[model samples]
Target: MSSAEKDKSPTKEVDTDELYQKTKDEIRPKLEYLRSVDDYCTSEAYEAISLIRETCKSLGRSKEKISKRVVDFMLEKGLAKLIVKILRSLVKRNDKSAYESRAKTHSVAKILQSNVKSREKKKVRIELVKCGIAYPLLQDLGACDPNTEDPRQRIRIITDLFSLRLLTEYDNPSVIPIYRSAKAVDILMKFAQVEYAIIQVRSLMLLATIVNEEESSRIVASGECILTFVEMLQKAIDSKDHHYLFDIKIDEENEKEFFMTGNRLTEGLNNLASNDANKSAIIQYGGVATLTSILRSQTSKGEKQEAIEALWKLSFVESNVEVILAHLNFDTAALEELKKMKSSDDSKLRDASTGLLHQLEMINIHDEPPEEKGSSDDQCHDPPPSYEETMSGMNVMISYNWDHQERAIQIRDKLKQKGFNVWMDVDKMRGNILKAMADGVEKADAILMCFSRKYKGSACCQAEANYAFKLRKPIIPVKVEQDYDADGWVGIVTGMDMYISAYSDAVMEKNWSQLFGELESIEKKD
Candidate 1:
């Protein structure tokens, strides 16, 4: 082959195998040296270099190709780490003043200067109206002379003044300039974005309080503003910060306002309960996933309590009930946690759980209207059964007319001798009259209704009867007087016959034996 022919053959294509080999020989040592440096050590960088080097050596390729690839890989990884560190530091500092000062001194002043010069030439008043400025200050700034040669400098001064006004609003409410401009609110909200989630929550709450109705409407209307507020709440929840959850204080004056405004943001959460519009919002905003995460956290007692309360509210919306129930059913861990919470020692926790349980029960059972099932009056008259009488002890709740307090006591004393826990209104009616009655009725196995004319006249006697009937307990109506007709009573319990005793000294003396016989019969039936 001639020299010209050989040259036209692309110099024999500089054998790729030899080229890769050459490239790897030069870069491999450099990579190893760098990897030995602790500061530059990274598994990914090392792996990339090592793989390139091995491929080149195996293929007998040029070192230049391998070196170039390794360099690119290292640069990409290094740049990413550098960018992340920069962002982290910037986020940590969050210095709004620095940025604001720079903008005012440089950009804003130049624009203001030009506006002032134009105003002076036309002898026109130049007003700067920003949402953050007060009306009075805005009017003053507008009236400034624009004829000055350094109009840009004047503009800078105006921006500084505005910035100062904003800073004042942040520090002291009294220093807020006369301008009721939205500029101040905008600046404050932006500043709050730099603060921690806890601070952001508090600031948003305060802003919701102090901002005028019109201003609040405008701010909320701004999707960005509302989104920022939600983001703060989400971050706090994600952090598993129990302290933040309970730190929310709903004072009397602002409680309604907070809830009303918060409802808008929490609609998505509520939708989880009702599967309504809020559900879409929740899924869109990733709220459901966040809430599930919060529920999964091994939070403090207080946090758990707050979480449950929040969940309950979310579940209140019909659409979200299925979501909540699904979580409860599928998340066995969460369900176990909630079950433990039911037995919490904190009265508030217990009360909250009790209320939730009651709501759940009512919902599950499809609570029927009182009139549909039976009148409240019917419930008022049916007494509850007492605990079963045991050799250890038995409890009997005597529902009788206070007018028959004497007979009720006599019966109670006789039952006490038979090792029965007898709860008569006279002795048991102390703290929380209604609660005491409920306890007695709930704990009793058989309820003894001392039916008499006076029993119908007493509201308390009627209440006891109602509770017993609602409980579907065994009730024995003992007619204590001849004139009292059991058939006329509202809850005239049948199947169990009534025992009548004369109001005489002779019968009163034998009341113990008579009561014992009735008690035995009730036990035998059980």
Candidate 2:
């Protein structure tokens, strides 16, 4: 073999299992000493921590399976808590040596960022949250000089920000009180405005989760927050490179995170739109035009959905509704897309589009001259403006136990694709399940009774089925489980009807065609 070819050849792989088993006993004593010691300032503590840090480095990245075993051992011995305490103590000191010891910050961040299984990482993050890790990380963010030219310092700050993002990703309620106590909203808002893409994205993500109420939303709306999101979204629309909104050279590996910037920005706007004043602010910022632009462009379905939802929320404000109508009139293609979405396969998209169109139409009629009041063939119109008038077509609600949610979702998607409005608890139903189910039943033109042994036994499913029967809604019996015969209450309600089987994907095509035929029959009867 050539020398270069030899260099490219694979080397002997390390047996991480054997290595971990061999060295864990030796590593335990050092960890125990560090965990018991309160002050990491002493020489003995420094020596032991240095050894552990080196050991972590030797374990390689958390992407390797064996490294996690070592991390788990260290965590079991309380090293994770020790590292946080060290960080807390270090944050109070402005000494050079204290700054040097920030290596522990990197170590802990690495441990949390481990590419171990997702569930395991989630569990580890929740456990570390209890260790009071957030406060110290926030302190690090507050202390770091954002504009420093030093690469190490930038990396250190990025590590701190990433750790904070992971902790807040799940939006645990416990973090809110702690964040409120630390005035985290203000801290995060400051970083959200930074020019650095990584820091800004993480900060915006953190802010989106914590800014959950009217008071917080109003607070953000009063600042440049709304405009910031508007500007980012506008940049994405203008450049047509939906992946990178910011003017940064992103590596291939990091491109996915930056690609979500549009979604995150729209989500931030959605959260803030809960407050009425914020809705007005969004309109004034030209957010309506930009969101409409998203619909006009070839953006992802998720981004489009978020944009539509945001516009729908803003539509409630009278002035904002006028602005939306004016913009849509000028952008005829976007208006067409909005109208087409009324028949979108996504239930939420269809619902939002119908509602937004209804608002625009009602406001237009109120503002029109009497001579122009009579509806023209080209102008949009709806039945007399009422709550139910906002929704159209035959709304089908899928009644099934949670055990058969997958099957129900498949049916829901198929019906939606066939131009039927579908309401399933997993998507359309939110808030109180009982109340939502009742509303679902009352509004539904037909109910798909998905049956299985477990589904027949479920109280919630029983309630949904019985309620639909009482409302005299047309029931389409569907067998969600293979070879399952419905008996008891289910059999009585769906007596002797043709059963549409949705037991598996292989049979879905035939099942959907049959179900569509049934829906067609109902439509004709109505």
Candidate 3:
């Protein structure tokens, strides 16, 4: 207490914590409601936030401290409209660039820039999203145009909110409404193309979440969102940037960035393609191949599952059957991965594997050894005769699906070698299919029906059979699949006629010989 000691008095630090604690007690009672961020926009949050802002200023706190306290109050009340309002106020008029000069910088920008490395800021961002800030933030992201004043600051605020949500509020339901909002998809899509990896991936992440639900899948599929999603996947796949989920090399250092973009983009594509409407567009855009590449990436198990599922949906289209089956070829690494999955301990993997295998087989892809080497001396190697022979009078019109065209072609070559003209449209179908079928049947002596499940399933093939029958052309039913219910058009045309069944080699040869004899009998009848 001496004059010398007093002269050397130490300045005491004002306890912001005690100040905050006491303020909380006093403020809580005086304030009517101290709940969500929305309270800031409400009549109740106004006085409390202003009080905290003033007290922090009066406490001789730094600008950063005042901002922190204001944020704390906003965060405590759920950081709702009041934060966005304050943030909007901080944005400089007509400035929208991240690299904008500091002279024009807004206080909100300063706070966000300061907190860019702040953990508390991170948590507050998430809390803000939980308080339903994502909706308005997303609206700004989508709604703002190049002409909007403070566009850059607005974008930063919107993106910052998303960055925080991605870090913390990943599973929140509030995200669904964000994309469902007007122009939200466009805004997200634009951001998704940003040069920055963080911005692009975070935008894609939000998109994936929005499309995760079946009902919202349509909204995500609207306009170029589907195409953009697919293009993102195509770029990732083209770059070969996915990390296999169960692989040994999944370390953070090597593939973290690429895998992040690839995984999120793939997830979004899968979710959007879950809607059947999107599948046709996807297949049209060659997205099936891109998706196959995703599976080939051997990315995460979840990502691969999503690709498999999207492919499964694409496979349902008969026109897409070839594309899907092509991806399962033996040379492609994806097939082996799928085959390995068939015996996996994971039930989902095993089931998806089994289903895909069955689907491929149904699409005419089968597991088999290399085709047996033909004998060196076989005279069947002899070529067919001149075109005059084919144009000569009677021919055998074989009705079949393109799936079994190889077999149909083999039989045509055999008939041609045997001096019988065989008119079979294997790969080419010119002009109107029905008209072509009618003309082909009209010029034929008899129609050799390559009857099977696929033949039954094809409308065009059935059309030929029906037309040939109506033309009074002798219908010869060749059963390719044993016990195949030939009970439809085949039964109607042949009328319980004895047919050649070729389910195996012995049966196939026997049927082939019988078919030739039947042709000879028909030749005699002619």
> lDDT by residue for model 1 over 1-526, one digit each (tens)?
9988987886445665576456547555544554344332244433433443344233222244543443344333342232122222222222444223233222222222232222121111112212222332333233333232333324332343433333232123232333234344553444334323333333344344234433444433433433554564465555433322322323444321112122222322221222122223433344444454544575455545544554554444456666666666777776665655554555344433433444344222123212222322222323332444546345678888665677777777767777777776563322124445667888887788887644543334554676688798777666665543443233345333556463555776766567677677776776
Clashing pairs in 2: none
Off by more than 4 A, model 1: 1-201, 207-284, 357-526
Q: What C-alpha lDDT values do all the predictions have?
A: 0.44, 0.66, 0.53
| Cα RMSD (angstroms) for every candidate in the order listed | 28.8, 15.5, 23.1
| Candidate number with the higher lDDT (1 or 2) | 2
Name the candidate, 1 or 3, with the larger TM-score value: 3
Index of the highest-TM-score prediction: 2
lDDT of 2: 0.66
Residue by residue across 10-83, what tens digits does model 2's lDDT show? Answer: 99976877777766877788778876767766677767777777676665543456666876886788866877
Candidate 3: deviation at residue 452, Å?
Answer: 39
Quote the positional error of residue 110 for candidate 2 in Å.
Answer: 6.4
lDDT of prediction 1: 0.44
TM-score of structure candidate 3 = 0.40
How do the predictions measure up, each by TM-score?
0.27, 0.53, 0.40
